[model samples]
Target: MSSIIKLCSSLSSRYNPRLIVSRFTVQPRLCSSVKPSSGPSSSSDHDLKASHKVDNFERKILVWTGKYKSVDEVPKMVSQDTMERARNRMRIKIANYMMAATVVGCLIMVYSGKKAAERGESVSKQNLDWHKSYQAKADKTEKDYASKFEHMAREGAEAAKAN
Candidate 1:
């Protein structure tokens, strides 16, 4: 604890915020030397990349998965098992999301329906009322169009008689 406190004090004394260069100021590097990479993550990534080459036995799995029509179409140097595993993981994830969404939608529907019931809103009654109103509107429009058609027919007949 004492060493930690001493280290903190030393760091605090070394880096004074006011003495430091402002964010607006740009300072050129004192040393232009660049160090070589130790190659930790890169080496592991390369190994994983190289591991993707599929064995001849695993090629059939890829073909069975419908990703390729036949073994001949399957790539000789790719990891089919890894691709299949990734695809399966993705499918499971999507299925879980869809299930969750369905549950949420059902819950929302139930809550909204309950609220509407409280407000005396009936879907069947609303539908019947809508149809009734629509029919009334249709009847009114038909009557209007019928009168217009009758007037047009009379005018047409008079014109024919004049001709």
Candidate 2:
């Protein structure tokens, strides 16, 4: 740890921030004379309108994402690449939330199933018991119905003989 600290201290002493700032001096910039290089053109006008629309849309996205308070707070010029990056970040955030929800759901299911198992309650066992009881009840009902039909036929034959 001391060696690392000594190395950092030595590097900081050798680094001169003022020299770096002086080497990279800011220069004044000049733009167009606020006049069109060519006469008014329909294509240029359409391009400007389209670009403005794209910027406005990106600005709205930035504001909606909480990066800015309002559209006015966003910059006038924003690149398509930057907008795409913001969209990706939003998508990732949503995906993370979905994943977390799925994880929580799975945990709940697992915990409940474990507790049920501890109480000797199994889905397969319940299904098996239900099927056994249903089959037995169906068999008994069928036998009772068959016996009643036999007795009825016998009574009908006796009545015909007496007639």
Candidate 3:
């Protein structure tokens, strides 16, 4: 039992199942010794950093739980075998959900881009049609102006000759 407890404690430290504090000591103050500047907690920044880290971890756990809607914390109040099985089941379920969601999201993005490309191709075709119509009208106008110029020149020459 003692060995089991020690093992559990060791594993907890390694996995950080929860926060732990270390012991501290104070020096014996003499008349010449200046008064201590601050308490151990106040003097050490480790506590602040540890708390921040713990908070971040807790937030991540909360988010994961919210998204999955089901998960169990370690040291579960059940048989060890049952807890292990549950954890394994949860891991598999979460993995499947994440993979399915990712695949669906990727598919949606790909199809959306394909739709946009199709729309762009249709718009380009319309623009090409407009260009072709405008070009045909311009060609007809140019031909009409050329024929009028030639007719005017021929009539002018004939009038001069008669004069």
Error of 3 at 146 (Å): 51
* Candidate 3: residue pairs that collide: none
Encode model 3's per-residue lDDT on 51-151: one tens digit a residue: 32223333344335443243433222233444344456668878999999999999998898799887775667879999999999999999999999999
Looking at model 1, residue 81 earns an lDDT score of: 54
| Candidate 2 backbone overlaps, count | 0
**lDDT per residue as tens, model 1, 25-53:** 84443221357677757656655554566
The collision pairs in model 1 are 52-79, 54-78
Worst 10 residues of 1 by lDDT: 26-35
Candidate no. 3 TM-score = 0.28
Per-residue accuracy of model 2 over 84-122 as CA lDDT, tens digit each: 777787788789999999999999999999999999999
What are the Cα lDDT values of the candidates?
Answer: 0.72, 0.72, 0.60
- How does model 2 score by TM-score? 0.46
